[model samples]
Target: MTMFTRNDKGQDTASPATAQPVRSDAQPAASPVAETRRPQAQPISSSSAAHGTPSVSVISKALKITGQLESTEDIQIEGEIEGDVRAVSVMVGANAKVKGTVRGDQVQLAGQVEGKIEAKKVILTRTARMSGDVVHQDITIESGAFIDGHCRPEYGKAEVKAPGLKTVVAGS
Candidate 1:
């Protein structure tokens, strides 16, 4: 005998019917809880975020780099570097130290560099202590800066060729 039986009206009672199968091409309806918890995509705005200025790579005083550093943007060094550095602009902080070549379009030194510096524009502040040659198109040395090598204004020019060789007579 069935557990459920007919009522006075002669209609049998049963469980609810199963849900219909969803179509392959149709999108499923989202539940209210799921819809409320979903995150919405927002358009990014410059004023709310970082502007057009490219981010600069900074080497803080507590760190040191033993390998080369190359960047298309600016670099500010306040630590120690043992290998070469090439960037668009390099700024050596007052307490920084660099023992390798520094090459860039603009270089501003206020610390110590024991290697060469090659740039289109070089600025040596009062606290600068440089011990190697500087190859630059334009340079500014403050009154208290110390330099131990020659400052050559040859950046993009070929090495100077020796004057015309003097002809030597076999017998004079």
Candidate 2:
């Protein structure tokens, strides 16, 4: 039982050696005063000004989302999504599952998608399994990918517009 007990002293001692480098880095910092002030401000409040927000949002493998997801920045999904996803760039990870439409400037899928994909550029990787139509200005379907619906190169075409919108007169 004594042998099984953790020996944390070794790790604690090693931590000081690593900490010395950080101390040395702090000593030569261009703005030491600003760096000290930033830490003080960070402890007072957790704000985006202290640490900038990420430009890309990641949906981890453990997550399951059921509503529409819209973002101007890129999105990486490794979980399950049951509703529409719209982003500047969307990446569906190898094990991700999406059950609704995905719209983006660029879309890369390596997982299972059960609905339509509309994008300027679309890529289906070897392990991708798509069960619906894909509308893209440019598309690449890898050799081992599985697709059950049509792949149409008509992403930005007028025909892809809403059905009633095309029939409506501009002034009326």
Candidate 3:
């Protein structure tokens, strides 16, 4: 048998570009290895497996919140809040305003807070206007700051649970 197959009109019409060698065993052609292979998965490193990095959340001047805000990272507020805020560090900008409690490890205020502040370290800048109580372990108030409430060094004196820690009840 010849390598080229004949057409119905009995003419040899095999061209070099359109010709493929035929095998005697009659097996189908194999596909490329890349087409049938699966992609390899990347290994996870220890650094990538852990919590990647600490983040800083910002509340801009145009926004306002009326509910509670809590975070494990830092927070910078330049807006208005009508509820409590809890974070690792909190910075209230000069033109910002808050009408509720602010709780953190460190709290630096340069705006107006009409409620309470509970923190380990608290700083009231020159432009800070506070009209509520401040409970802190350490505090610094500038000369030009205005405060109208009690300043008590009562932070950590009570049993306070951290932001994300689970509290277990002993008795039913």
Candidate 4:
């Protein structure tokens, strides 16, 4: 149910941290898999690449892919995606809708996302309507944004207050 969103630029973004919950203990990791994606192994255009970095990949909206999606570039979800998704950065377009788990280094939600979303930074725009738990390092909920879920900002610093927990904003 996971799909890749490659914009006009050569970058593909999808986070890979939604598969597991936060753990305080260390555990063994999986072996790295070697896959070949370089078709011609040629230099890429500066405009199509991110920050002048070379990239080689293409994913259109007509193709609806499933299962786990992992990438190291920028990705835009314009169609629909189910299951888990991981990438460097993800942008869910206004008409795009995603169900299941979504993970990325940076995620911007403009459409509708159902399920859990984890990222380094998450932005809930005014047009976004989400129904799930969100955990990130930094989060922004716009004035008109509607989100019916729990939120946790990691930042890797102080512990986040959970639901039902007492929280006092500003001064009394």
Best by lDDT: 2
Instruction: Please report how far candidate 3 places residue 56 from its true position, in Å.
Output: 0.9
Task: Kindly give the stretch of ten consecutive residues in candidate 2 with the minimal lDDT sum.
Answer: 163-172
Query: For residues 17-99, what per-residue lDDT tens digits would candidate 1 score against the true structure?
Result: 21222221132233322232233222454352444444678999998999988776779999999999877789999999999
lDDT of each: 0.74, 0.78, 0.75, 0.62
Write the candidate numbers in order of decreasing lDDT.
2, 3, 1, 4
lDDT of 2 by residue, 58-131 (tens): 99999999998877678999999999988878999999999999988899999999999999899999999999
Candidate 2: segments with Cα more than 4 A from true spot = 1-50, 161-172
Candidate 3's TM-score reads 0.63
* lDDT (tens digit, per residue) of candidate 4 on 1-172: 0122112112211224222212211222221110112322335743644355443223345556576555666677777777776666788877777887777767898888899788878998989889998988889888887798988776344553221112212122
Q: For candidate 1, list the clashing residue pairs, or say none.
A: none
List, in order, the clash count of every candidate structure: 0, 0, 0, 15
| TM-score of candidate 2 versus the correct structure, residues matched by position | 0.66
Relative to the unseen true structure, what is the C-alpha lDDT of residue 167 in candidate 3, on a scale of 0 to 100?
30
| TM-score per candidate | 0.63, 0.66, 0.63, 0.55
Off by over 4 Å in 1: 1-54, 159-172
Write model 3 residue lDDT over 90-113, tens digit each, in one string: 999999999999998899999999
